[model samples]
Target: MDTQVIVLSVVADIVGLVSVILGFVAEKTKIKPSEIIVNDFVYCDYPTSSVLGMAISASLMLILAEVLIAIAGSCCGCCRTNAAGTGKSVVGIVLSVFSWFAFTTSFILFLVGAVNRGVNWQHLKIGDDCPLSSHLPGIFAGAAVLAFVAVSLGTAAAFLLAATPGSSSQYAQGVEMGRPQFQVPSNGTPPFNRPTI
Candidate 1:
């Protein structure tokens, strides 16, 4: 294993252990409940087909990010002397920042909620007094910022790797061999020749 991967594995294991411990503590203390109430649950409503379409879109984005990260890291070359090593470092830093943001944000949200005595997410018709807490907005905003930073770094790393001549040729060749090709008509004819476009 490369030094970076070893380091990351250790860090991830530590974080996971800490998270598990804290989770158990929270569960025992009854500070953070995990139950979800469906009565007041609200999600974006759309046509039935829209659900699958959106899911596929989201899945593609996630997969693209993961694949790009892997490519960048591997291209970085054993974390010893490759430029791809820098990419791995960037990804690691981004994740660390995100984890820190999440931890702090959750702590603040918990404090704000406990002090205010104003819980959110009330069951409207059920008359249950579950007021949607104010902390959720901050938590979501923090998470969004973190996600954007991580994705931006990942994209930049991928672009850098692809733009380099050596890796670019390899990636292009791989894609060419793996992806199906089709020709488009010069005239305005149907393009079923193109996959399910």
Candidate 2:
């Protein structure tokens, strides 16, 4: 494997782990039923839980890791556009885009799950529900898993892009539409032909 790939993988792993940790912490720190005051309206206690910060931090970490990996992988002409690299680039781009989508979903989930953790508006009856906002721990856990998946996919895509041909650092397919050409050596004699008297 390429050193660049190894480095990128390591960075992604670290970032992913950090995000996962934050997510789990968010889950743990979420508002509990005991912490809620019930009467007519519902609101969190003073100071609130730390879930909001954790969730938002996790989301930010994921985005930062994605951008850093992408920038580090192909910044040196490793992602040049050429026919020789079309297939690889397409697949790589697809994976990268999917990764982005996954992380985006996770970010939204995290945001939603944490948005209500600090609700202080005590005028919402919420249709006889005292919980006001009910967020399951599964939501935070699932979002963390998704963030990990996104990191893995993004690393794979960057590796593929680095492996593509025609990069300034890698072999080029030549100037002919960036396609490889094969030429047989000609010594004025046919390779498989013999003169018959």
Candidate 3:
């Protein structure tokens, strides 16, 4: 059960981290091409809708990550049997959960940044009326990268400790093979009467 929990936690952290990275990438790099208008038209200044959408999504994800980390840090304590062990477990759980959040956020942002999956960049043109600056995507993308680092490294460390061998583990405690010995033999001829079992 403990192993399973650790594994799940690690997996979650990774997923979250991946999400965060993708989010950041979507925000930073212009993977999607900006649509070109055929003729000169009345263009309004506006933030790239797709970027804006992704940013908003990433922000929400960031917030969620914080909450999950908090929860993992606290809840993970219950799984530990010792003070030091508890602390380590908490750290591990927190990191794993954080990674998952980061990964998930990044992946979502990436998906959002995708031309068809997310906001349509074609509707947003250069020098158009937009609410956000053109550079916001890059900023979010950077944040996502940071999140990935935190989550991946942290979770990995936690999992390593969790996987450590211990006395309590079944593998470390195997069945005894030696036979039991008796203090005295059942047959005794020296005492006059012999008894046998």
Candidate 4:
């Protein structure tokens, strides 16, 4: 319900959506094979698919969590006392953290794989020029950027939700309702008076 939470949720959701789109695009891009013919055998080079799969999975999880958080916040008045709403927020936070970890890991793996592939290609002694193109790498690079942005925004939203006052405690509503104050006796003595000193 807080303005900060709403803004963060929207930003995170948008970023996550973009990340998902980019990840899908990267996955769909065709990786041209570089074939090497030596004697009578031919070797083909193809990009690793695990990196793209991880990126897509991470983006999907982030977007899903963001949507659930937004729905719970809107429908439940962001009430901490609402068990279902609180649970959704907690789940969103956990999912966001997992997405971040997945994105980071995939990004690292993608970069390493790219570097290794390049190094290997350079070492190949082929009679003809390599036919490999940089298009797939470029697409993957874009996806990596999108994933990083989504991870950053999602993390920010998760932290904001966790820090929101009264967001995790059921007794917060009672405290917000204000507690009763006790009045002191005008005689400056205890209400249940003891023997005079």
For TM-score, the strongest prediction is 2
- Model 3: weakest 10-residue lDDT segment is 164-173
The ten-residue window of minimal lDDT in model 4 covers 116-125
Question: Order of all candidates by TM-score, from best down to worst?
Answer: 2, 3, 4, 1
Q: Give per-model CA RMSD.
A: 16.9, 11.9, 12.3, 10.6
Candidates sorted on lDDT, descending: 2, 4, 3, 1
Predicted model with the maximum lDDT: 2
- Compose the digit string of candidate 3's lDDT tens values, residues 10-52: 5557556555755655555443334333234554322234555
TM-score of each: 0.29, 0.69, 0.42, 0.37
Model 2 weakest 10-residue run by lDDT: 75-84
Model 4 Cα lDDT, one tens digit per residue, 23-133: 555445434453333333344344444444444454465556445544434322344444344554666555555555655654553444344332223334345544444
User: Candidate 3: deviation at residue 43, Å?
Assistant: 9.0
lDDT (tens digit, per residue) of candidate 1 on 18-85: 43333333223321223334442442111112222222232233334444454444433223232333
lDDT of each: 0.37, 0.71, 0.48, 0.50
Number of the candidate with higher lDDT, 1 or 2: 2
Clashes of 2: 0
